[model samples]
Target: MHDRDQDIIVCRCEDLTLADIRALIQKGYRTLDEIRRISRCGMGPCQGRTCRALVQRELQASGINIKDQVPGVFRPPTKPVTLGSIAEGAGRRSDHA
Candidate 1:
């Protein structure tokens, strides 16, 4: 990558760049949760699967020891859910009502 083209996009899913993360860090958002909540960095479809490590690296570089920090919340059902199943469940719920 050329010097001018060296745009470090930490979160492609949320379009978060390195500059964005730095600004958040400068703003006293020390923890990943703070950054994630304010910038929606990890709330994309991939659920930070790709960006978590990058973000952690940035945090560590910023002098924040992330060794003890929880990487991020990962709920169950890691795989994607189908819309058809959602519709089926909704129908079942309505029937019970």
Candidate 2:
């Protein structure tokens, strides 16, 4: 079945729709923490590093005060690096610039 309503694709990895988030907001789900808990927007391969800012903007548009908005939970590493780079050992040092 085709989705009649086209919403913004927030999390490509998790396939979260903007409508889903808006509905949550309409349901009195304010703040990033509440939104994440209900809609799971940032729970994806890239995590919130991808769409946290956009989500915050949308939340602000709804008249929610987000000044003290803290970031969502973070998982391991914080950076996704290639295994080959680690194995190489001889990573690029200085002098290139």
Candidate 3:
């Protein structure tokens, strides 16, 4: 992660750079909530499964308080499903795997 290549991509959906996030952290934007609100980090399709932890650690290294930082909520299904994927007649899929 040396130097983050100076131009490394961070939030791939929004095309935000590590440099941009770091600059935000260097200012007073000290929480994941704050970062997301202002910089739009984890509001993308991958849903922070990739970038959330990176953003969290980066902010923490900058002295942010993450213990109470309030990561986003997880709603039902918790996995993606298309409406067509739902079956009219169904027993749930087996867990045999």
Candidate 4:
């Protein structure tokens, strides 16, 4: 592959390049979840919102059939949560007990 392609930033949140992902795939980290756990590619602020598709594309280019490959689960609170809300919820729960 060309240097430009390798240097392509797939996950900007983690500053990961395509080469980084390719290396992970070659090491048998084929699934998105596996790569995420090891390289922390999509575990960023976007939570794969931006990088999931890119990761899938990379996997496909590497000859992996991603049609059945389930992407990693993305939990809620996609944005930052304030500590005050957490404390308030905890207090309410304690009152019911």
Candidate 5:
């Protein structure tokens, strides 16, 4: 592959390159979940929303049928909740009750 293609960013959230993905595939990382877990590809703020398709495409190109592959597990973003907010919400609920 050309250097330009290698330089292409597959996962912008994690700054992972196409070359990185290819290397992982060559190393026998077949499932999307495996790749994500090992490389943190889909563990970024955007989750796998951005890179999932791109990585899948790569996997397809490498002769892996994505349909049968185990998909990566995406966790919901963790939002920080202050204790004050929780207490205020509880107070409001009590007032309503």
Candidate 6:
């Protein structure tokens, strides 16, 4: 593959390129879920919003119909709370009581 193809960004959040996707497809990865589990392609903060279609396209190009594959699942994004912050909030609530 050409260097230009390597520069085509498929998943910006994960820094994955089109070439990377193609390589995975060539390696017998036929489903979006398989690709996600192996490469964490659609498992980033955007949660497959950006790269799902791209990966599906690659799979289709490799002669795999996406309709037969298990769909990618996106989980709700969670913001991590620090233990100290939780403790502080609890202390404030107790003091008010």
Candidate 4's C-alpha runs over 4 A off are 88-97
The number of the candidate with the highest lDDT is 4
Report the lDDT tens digits of candidate 6 across residue range 5-52.
799999987899999999988888778988888998977777778799
Q: Provide the overall lDDT of each model, using Cα atoms, as 2-decimal numbers.
A: 0.84, 0.73, 0.74, 0.87, 0.86, 0.84
| Candidates sorted by TM-score, best first | 4, 1, 5, 6, 2, 3
Candidate 5 TM-score to native: 0.76
**lDDT tens readout by residue for model 2, 1-97:** 1264245676676677777667778889888988877777776667788778878887998898789777666877567667898656545543343
Comparing candidate 1 with candidate 2, which one achieves the higher lDDT? Answer: 1
**TM-score (all chains, Cα) for each model:** 0.77, 0.67, 0.67, 0.80, 0.76, 0.76
Write down the TM-score for model 1: 0.77
Give a tens-digit lDDT track for model 5, residues 2-96.
Answer: 68867799899899999999999999998888899899997777788889998999999999999997676656435446779989999999999
Report how far off residue 45 is in candidate 1 (Å).
0.3
Off by over 4 Å in 6: 78-97
Q: Write the per-residue lDDT of candidate 1 for residues 1-97, one digit (tens) a residue.
A: 2343248788888898888888888889988899999999988888888888888888898899999898778975586688899899999999999
Candidate 5 pairs with clashing backbones = none
List where candidate 5 sits over 4 angstroms from the true fold. 78-97
Winner on lDDT between 2 and 4 is 4
Name model 3 segments beyond 4 Å from true.
1-5, 75-97
- Using alpha carbons, what is the TM-score of model 2? 0.67
Residue 30 Cα positional deviation in candidate 3, in Å, after optimal superposition? 1.3
**Candidate 3 per-residue lDDT over residues 16-91, each given as its tens digit:** 8888888888787888778877987877766666778888888778776778768766545566676666652243
